[model samples]
Target: MRILLSILLVLLFVPDWSGEPRLPLLPDAAAFRVEQVVLDRRDPARTKLGGLTYLGGVELHGPGPAFGGFSAMMVEGERFTLLSDGGNIVSFVMGGDWTPRAVRFAALPAGPGRGWHKRERDSESLTRDPATGQLWVGFERANEIWRYAPGFAAAQAHSAPPAMVKWSSNGGAEAMVRLRDGRFVVLAEDRRGSVKGTVRGLAFNSDPVKAPRHGFTFSYRPSRGFKPTDMAELPDGRIAILNRRFAVSSAFTAALTLVPRAAIRPGAVVTGREIARFESPVRHDNFEALAVVREGRDTILWIASDDNQWPAQRSLLLKFRLDI
Candidate 1:
């Protein structure tokens, strides 16, 4: 069956979530630095990729071994926050100069975990309320959602939804976005839907962390051979979802797709239209985090990769102008 094949492929080849688990960080803050990278290693002069125009990017370097399994990220203005599946948090402020400021790192104060093991805190998806600065994180294994105060000061509330109880531990909530219409959408990583090659999705009428008892169901089908990893709300209210695929020859590749706002009604089966692809000569890694922001009249996209703490891989952060 296709589901079996997909899971087998992910277990054997995908490093985004299947790679060696990142160890827990110490009580002291971790440290890291960034180095700029090009859009295309084959040709640094290239600037276009599908609907995206490359601005710049960086490869993150941390002294500690447990530094880069980043699965979700949030961006507001020049500040960025990256969260790893193991509950590690890294924050920094960077501008056009490509220099990082106020670089700080810490672990989540609390999670669905008993503060014992990494699997207990397998956070994969994140969305936030920009107006109130509240953040919501979805944890796998436990199939729970947790809300945090601004700046991740503390955990406010959490819940375990009955709908997500049956989702696989590693595939529970992989992509999430807070829509402008006061709804939150979550996409499972590998939970198949009624339609073949589709994953289950849920729309929360309000904050799922505080009221996770109810939601409407839907489905999302990414491009062939790809699964949703992260999502963001576009400036125009559409949804930008990040899908990733792995191949032995390429290592890791990604697809950025867009789903129209009107197509997400309850029980609907939504398929994203491919807007960009990261493959072949284009520089890419296990990109798992996505964030959209607006600057002046332009909408910008920020993407980050989960290196799985592998020496051969990289913790990459990139920015682009969404020309389309």
Candidate 2:
């Protein structure tokens, strides 16, 4: 009887390693390491943006186990918000020096699934309505999008649009953006239909859940061997997309491309012009987050990497300027 009682106590007190751990509502920030890096080591003194400039970046570390895996981001001046693939939120304010301050961290208030596994909460893309302060997050495995109130207080609505039904479980809705004209666009990560390098793009008339059927399809041609990760809208109304590629020998590379607004219509096969590329000799990682902010006369671009919560890779955030 005593042995059974001891076993019961152990089972009750000890956490089960088989399931996903419950994350805290707000996690404390630890010491984060920031480093000034150059995009091309050969030209470390280059200060120009547009193409690629080596702005300062950071290697974020935290007390909690869920720190990296950032897949999407939104930037408003010095204020930034990041959404991790593991369904965590990391927001902070930074200055021109690229040092983060007033950092805050939290997990998504609600997820699509029962939260039993990480895939069930694989949030890969994010977008925001600046006018209303509403935010939208796209979950991959479930192929659904959830709209949240400002500050992520609550999930207002959710939808699994029919256009995303055929997308691969791990590659669904990898990039999403709300255009200034009030249209929402969602791009699949790995749904190559009839054409190679061609992914499906869905454009919604309004909020997805409210009008799920009011959407049309288009084709997006990413760079060869690369897949679209995130997207942002330029002040000029063009769309900027971040594409990524990974290989066994080359590791990872990324590119930024610009799609003209005129080409984003229904049934159109759209391919953007590559503006910048990050490859060997350039300090690049798994850069998955992209956000654009318009300053006085300059358009600032921000890109962040996902460390995959691995020891080898570092979470890097880079800033640039779009000279267009």
Candidate 3:
């Protein structure tokens, strides 16, 4: 009986090594580690979140700084690459056993102004061509889109579209996606849409950075008070967009919405129908990265959060089974 009481006392007072929240030790460096975290600390067995089924998730940690702020993601097979707004990159492979392997820490080989400052490399959006491995990154503040060679080995080209010049420096190009049909879609983070509840978007017939003038204007209406933060092309050619909303009292909340591929065209006004919600009972954060992949017949969704290098928040990477 005495031993039992002692064990209970320790359990009550000692924090679970895995559950204790810790900030990135190094916020401005490219080194970090990944640890598995529960989907919901409040409800470990709960998995359903609207139309998504929780597959798994991880919390990335690093020395005091330079680790979080991840705003874009790419999931190819078992490899995961997360890109931060400040130009840092983290890549790793997690296999069926959920063990991370081949971990690599790197930064964009080259970017605006030599990437000397965080604002100079505020890469808020990313997209890739599966066939060529070429990548496109949208940098806010500069309102420019840069194309990189496969593996981000080199910056091939960049252009600041006149259309984007007037957008809010910190609110430009928050979401971008390359469709399977050889087109691209770019959405502004703050530019108001033609409609009250929508945001401004553009559809490019060719590479956006190469032919920024070739696309037409469009609009995307998200859930009320939410702004589209990131987007990905679904396997069926539809568009999957992530809508985020946060206030002091509400914290962070997100809505998963979809737009028909056909609705993205010249002078088109598209609406994203809400398919899922991430709030109260489920895992939620300052989610700004989103990616879609396919496994057999199941469609997969990977979402990440930008902790903004704050100790109170966390850099989260979550995987979900997209049923709808």
**CA lDDT of each candidate?**
0.89, 0.84, 0.86
Ordered by lDDT, highest first, the candidates read: 1, 3, 2
Between prediction 1 and prediction 2, the one with superior lDDT is 1
The candidate scoring highest on lDDT is 1
Q: How much is 20 displaced in model 1, in angstroms?
A: 14
The regions of model 1 sitting more than 4 angstroms off are 1-22, 26-30
Cα-lDDT of candidate 3: 0.86
Q: Which residue ranges in model 2 land beyond 4 Å of their true spot?
A: 1-26, 29-31, 47-50, 53-55
Worst window of 10 by summed lDDT in candidate 3 = 17-26
Candidate 2 matches the true fold with a TM-score of 0.91
lDDT of 2 by residue, 1-324 (tens): 999898788668755434346543335643454666666678777655446544556556655557778899999888988888888888888888767788887788887875546777899999999999999999998999999999999999998898888789989999999999999999998898446779889999998877888979999998888899999999999999999999888788898999998798888899979988887767778999999987788888889999888888878888787776
Q: Write one digit per residue (lDDT tens) for candidate 3, span 1-324.
A: 999898788668754423433222234434556788777779998788878899888888766567779999999999999898889888888876667778777788877765656667899999999999999999999999999998899999999887888889888999999888889889998888787877889888889888989878888888888998999998888899998999898799999999989988766678888988888767789999999988899999999999998888889888899888
